[model samples]
Target: VEVSGLPPNLNRSCCDCGVYALKYIESHMLNLPLDLINEDNIREARLKLAVDLWAASKDPVLIDRMEKYEPHNNSSDIVDVS
Candidate 1:
């Protein structure tokens, strides 16, 4: 499938970037002819890939900003219906 025109702010926030990462893997990487991920190696591979990406970006400020976000507190004023 041809995926295009992702949201402009897809990488603006940590959550959005995470979603984008998952989408990217699903759309592109998963189709590659490799069986590197399975029940036994998935966890290790996931952590390794995340660390590698973080190192490649070399943007600790963005990581700190993402860590500081508190969506739950931001929406605390709203009443929950369920």
Candidate 2:
């Protein structure tokens, strides 16, 4: 079944397209409103997803790499991966 009224693919990049697809599916699954899903805040959504995934990851190598890339001075755990 096709989902209607999903946010338009404004960026047109493969990465952005994937993000839109997943978000649309997720909203549909959760019976959430689709209005919040838009191009304007997709970058922020993507960043949040990345941080969440990174935090949840248990791979030692990836964790080490993330630590190197993530800021060490910040007291907050969230990485500014943007």
Model 1 weakest lDDT span, ten residues long:
33-42
Error of 1 at 58 (Å): 1.1
lDDT string, candidate 1, 1-82, tens digits: 7654444533433434443455457646557422332345445555776797878677888778888977764554768799
lDDT of 2 by residue, 1-82 (tens): 8548544446565578777767878888998888778777888889988887877797888878878895558576778878
Top candidate on TM-score is: 2
What lDDT does the true structure give each of the candidates?
0.55, 0.77
How does model 2 fare in lDDT?
Answer: 0.77
Clashes of each: 0, 0
Error of 2 at 35 (Å): 2.0
Q: Quick one: RMSD of model 1?
A: 11.9
18 Cα displacement, candidate 1 (Å) = 9.9
